[model samples]
Target: MQTRNRVAMSRRAFAGSLGALVLCAPAVARAQSSGVVRRNTSGFKLHNWQDHFDELGKGIIISDTNSRVMQQWMPGGEMFIYPTSVPMTDELTRRGYTEITFKDPAPDWTPTPSMRERDPSLPAYMPPGPDNPLGARAMHLSWQYYRIHGTHDTRKIGRRSSSGCIGLYNEHIIEVYDRTPVGTQVKLI
Candidate 1:
């Protein structure tokens, strides 16, 4: 019994030491995204890169496939690195896009026209409803064209699959939307 305890203790010590070593590695302190910056997060995810901080003010530049070039704030250096992009650029503009316009007010993401069009078989959007995809609010970047918004589907949070809009968990997106406006520049490169 005593020997087994010692083995367990040793394993824990080794894991702690290895974690410390990884955090202290040169990989953490330096910029890996060309001119883009990197910051670590404490959110519980197994991947190191997925631990990147969230800085919505920091805009993101994405590849054609919706893959991102790390993340940075608009007009500033504050940023974080996320592994995914909303609707990802390619997916966003892939089809059914009209000229950009400013929606008079935010629309419900659940039963809205765009939502129905995207998924005819899916349920509808009703404001302040629990399943509302728009969560609390969505920053209307291009009228109905695109947005950065809150989501009820938290499981989809860091993945590349989205309509053509960026998805943030309800809390995070609401915080961002409150600060954004109709003319805000959303550059999906």
Candidate 2:
């Protein structure tokens, strides 16, 4: 009887301690974990594009690098997930928000200065075709040097092998390209 009472008390103590720990965490931690933001303002305030998903509507793309998934929120609240190759390093896929600056069907490929420095063997440029890294479609983002494009290698989809740009399968990118227009916002998280 004494042992049972002690066990009950211990459980209650653990529950109380867990509650306290959660309460003690910073508001930002809570906000990020919940993917919800609360604003308090009497004057003008800077808004984070990530927090206003609904306002952005159909053109919003949320890339979860950890999960290797690109979720597009279409107008009227319809969401679609496209498997993609996310970058391995934060430097490659910097966290931020940007809008699509341009869209190209079968975009030409050119190794960036940084890319060539890393890989000396890469050619200077390759015309849009099956051999091109930027497969069937590409969407350039306002974040300089970053893009969402299709891959010639379909096996790379849903993996972490990209230099920086997010990559989907050729056919999948065709679908995304058909739907996503220029000026669509993309948030890499």
Candidate 3:
């Protein structure tokens, strides 16, 4: 009788565990299918271009600092998303509307005044190269000292590591630079 009771308890525990797993299966499947799991560990959600743009004049770029993701919408309504490195802190972040003033295929780097003040050892100027912080390309924004640019340190992508700019992987920035044009509207949020 004792052995039979032990077996019944074990079976009940197994059934309960199995039931719990079955209940959780749909949520896991849904998250994976919806791209909330595989794309980013930061819980980044895809954005709709219409939410941030009045019209797709030229094109639009929206960088979400919270999610560390940049979403681009082309004139014809196609969209692309890329992971990004955002400002390291809220104080370093600049929000609101801006436009791409120009593009540099081989962008140079110059630490901003505040950046220099914070880190006096930083070089005053760096010419474009593999060693340059601005990796392969850069899209200058209307705001001075701000850019949506590539970084040599690929680890910075999908993290809060930039001083004030949005940083992308070198390959990703090259693609973005090719797709985006001067005067493309951008919003940082």
Q: Estimate each model's TM-score.
A: 0.53, 0.71, 0.78
Ranking by TM-score: 3, 2, 1
- What tens digits encode model 2's per-residue C-alpha lDDT throughout 69-188? 777765654555566888867778777778889999869989889899999999999999989999999999898778899998988886788889999888778978998978887888
Residues 26-143, model 3: lDDT tens digits: 4554353323233333467677778887799999999999988888878987666778999999999999999999899888888999999999999999998989998999999999
Specify the highest-TM-score model's number: 3
For model 1, the local distance difference test gives 0.49
After superposition, candidate 3 runs with Cα above 4 Å error: 1-42
Whichever of 1 and 3 has more lDDT, that candidate is 3
Worst 10 residues of 1 by lDDT: 44-53
lDDT of each: 0.49, 0.76, 0.86
Each model's backbone clash number: 9, 1, 0
lDDT ranking, best first: 3, 2, 1
- Give the best candidate by lDDT: 3
Error of 1 at 126 (Å): 1.8
Root-mean-square deviation per candidate:
9.2, 11.0, 7.6
